[model samples]
Target: MFKDTNQEDYGSTRVEKDSIGEKKIAADSYYGINSIRARENFNISRENVHPELIRSIAVIKQAAAATNYELGLLEEGKKDAILEACSEIINSNVAEELKLDAFQGGAGTSTNMLVNEIAANRALEILGHKKGDYHIIHPNDDLNKGQSTNDVYPTALRIAVLKLLVPLTESVSKLQSALQAKEKEFSSIIKLGRTQLQDAVPITLGQEFSAYAEAVNRDRWRLYKITDRLKKINLGGTAVGTGLNTSHSYIFKIAKQLRNFSGLSLSHSENMIDITQNMDIFVEVSGLLKAAAVNLNKIASDLRLLASGPAGGIGEIRLPAVQAGSSIMPGKVNPVICEMINQLSIEVICCDQAITMAARDGQLELNAFGPLIASKILKSLEMMKNGIDKFVDKCIKGIEVNQDRCQQILDNSLAVITSLVPYIGYDQASILAREVRESDKTLRELIVEKNIFSKSELEEILKIENMTSPGRKK
Candidate 1:
């Protein structure tokens, strides 16, 4: 049964019905009955489907319009109207109006229909017709012709993910470059390296930062590789990946049009059936995201620990005091940026777990959790990108090493005895380290006073360059 309610307060009204029931929509609403039902049924997460995904869906719709028009399957006027409407969505913020839930059910069928209804109603308007006039320009018959949610949804999901990764990769690369610059700038500043939270040996602050840069470099490389994986699409594999209702000729044409429209290296998957049934690619992507998150967490934790105390903790480096550390402790500063990134990484890790489980939960021909997987992966990518940008600007680029503290700790610690084990035997070096620690004497003080080696020899052996690198001592 269809029920019509007065929509005067909302705007001019339109009545639309689907198989399940009917409802009233705002007169100018670009979405129709199916989208309205989705919004009502999946009020789980208030968040909308990602804008990038919505844009990708528009691109797919526009590409389909062009392909169908070229094949003479659709008239010129309908194709032009569909293209114009999809362009409105691609170029404008039209998706904000759809408001389909991010955590919707039905393996993203609701999302696919949301895009279809918007495109159809908007195309109707473009053709100077009213919304819900499906006979003239139907959502399924015209806008989503030759496609299924199974094929279209995942294809759009891959495109949106690929697009989002561009900015993410750039953000990570910027962070890596900043860290590399810090490495070069701090190259001459010596500090004590630690293992298992115990002082181990002498190293330059530059080396520590260089390790971080290298870790990020690996993450950047991984992002590029996974983006290539996302390019293998399933656009032509209608309904269970068998090209059931779609003509054979239009299959590759749709892929071509999509590639041209989206400017991606998109190709139809070799085995569309396998792609339709499995979501392993997303699992691989989630794993990469998890790895990057782990690196960010480790680096942030290191920064927080190193910046822990101006008077109590390691205090090897000073992070920018962007905000007050505490309300009660006067003059207290916190590593808030690092802590924020640390927490963001934990969230990303949890998102990876969600994605992994969603990917694994697919039934015979489709996964009912595609929307959840897509939403979580995209959210993780966006969160990581934003977190990294802030971390670089607010923390990494503003970090300043406590040079005197580094040198003082380096000179006083018995860990510098590691450098001496090469010249002196390990047994002698161990004895000297124990004596230096028990007597509370600096390594240089004890060495010089005991005449362990000449001042020139000590200077050469203890040089940071020699200790940090594998080369003969000067």
Candidate 2:
């Protein structure tokens, strides 16, 4: 067992050479020379490329193989091997083994080459050849036939982003549903609404939650709109969008094949050059994601404040306690999930800034920062999704209303006097508001004591449901 372990660790290394130099590789590594050099050179970020992107690259390679076979550029056996290898990468959990950093230069050449080498070597193994025996199925010449890093990298990035959007959109929908359910549940529960951190008017707790649901629904719609924009890819625009060594037939057919394979409504960009150089679409998507983050932060902050205290703060709502909030306090429970969402939103907003800068820094022909852009946006989407799911399940669904507290606050607020303005003159309402605030009398008490109207009439006018909507203008 010791000898076998030694062989697995040391004796399994094989030599593979490239233009720069040669390096010893693990015998069973799907990646070849370029990937090994990239791993050594790009020691930045220490994180593996996102697995969604890995799957996206494999999906593209599989589509390319099918297109190449249809165009008679690849033999059926070679195409079969490539397709099988891509399926293996997609279906298996092999992403951690790729080892390419998400921060690299060369307009994503290292990433594209990394995927190419993995697919090529895996195909070679499928054909009963050793990993570096690329003479039988060369990574560049055959596996990456008619494609370039410039084209393939952005195309795969779009596919990966689009793929993630499906789940992210679903998560947002779930959040909206959760908020909507709370709205319906709390619809009749009256609470004091505020502006400028001061009391303003009476509103149903349901209306507040309804607004949150609507905001999330709008975000879901925006996500769908951006997904349509991401479907336009520059797949056939090799090296510089001139389709240099690739034929028009291959260019057009690749899109069709990719659409078929990915089940996405994909199309080739009409101006491949523009697609290759301009990353504005990614920036637009990031901006929309930031908008959702803003909404999330606002909602989370509101929940934290509403759940702030049972004794000191605006203890209008109770959030479900998932864990002990304080280490030292005897009976302390905290709004931890809301705080987590707040921090996640901040992180997403920061990631959007990084993506915006990377998109802006692209020079002519290619952006060397594609990897950075992909990493930021993917991380933002995934983090937001996970955060949203947990928030909905643990926090939103279990929230309980403090009904008596809400009524006590509402009865004491002077802002509810606005509901009396239509019944009384504005001047009278103002004086009454000042008198009520200065004395030890509540709004309901003063109205009853003064006999401003009959008790039943005042009760009818100050009804919570009547105050929530428009009444006769005076």
Candidate 1 per-residue lDDT over residues 1-474, each given as its tens digit: 012222455667778877877788887667688877777788887788998888899899999999999999999999999888888888877665557789888888888888888888878887889878889999999988999999988999899889889999999999999999999999998889999999887788999999999999999999998887889988889889999888767888998999899999999988898888888898898899899999999999999998878888889899998988789999998889999999999999999999999988899999889999988988998999999999999999999989988878776677667878777889998888788768877788789998989898888887766777777663
The TM-score that candidate 2 achieves is 0.95
What does candidate 2's lDDT look like per residue over 132-151, in tens digits? 88789999988789899899
Which lDDT values do the candidates have, in the order given? Answer: 0.87, 0.87
lDDT (C-alpha) at residue 434 in model 1? 83
Candidate 2: minimum summed lDDT over ten consecutive residues — where?
1-10
TM-score of 1: 0.95
RMSD of candidate 2 to the true fold?
Answer: 2.7
Query: Cα RMSD to native, each candidate?
Result: 2.9, 2.7
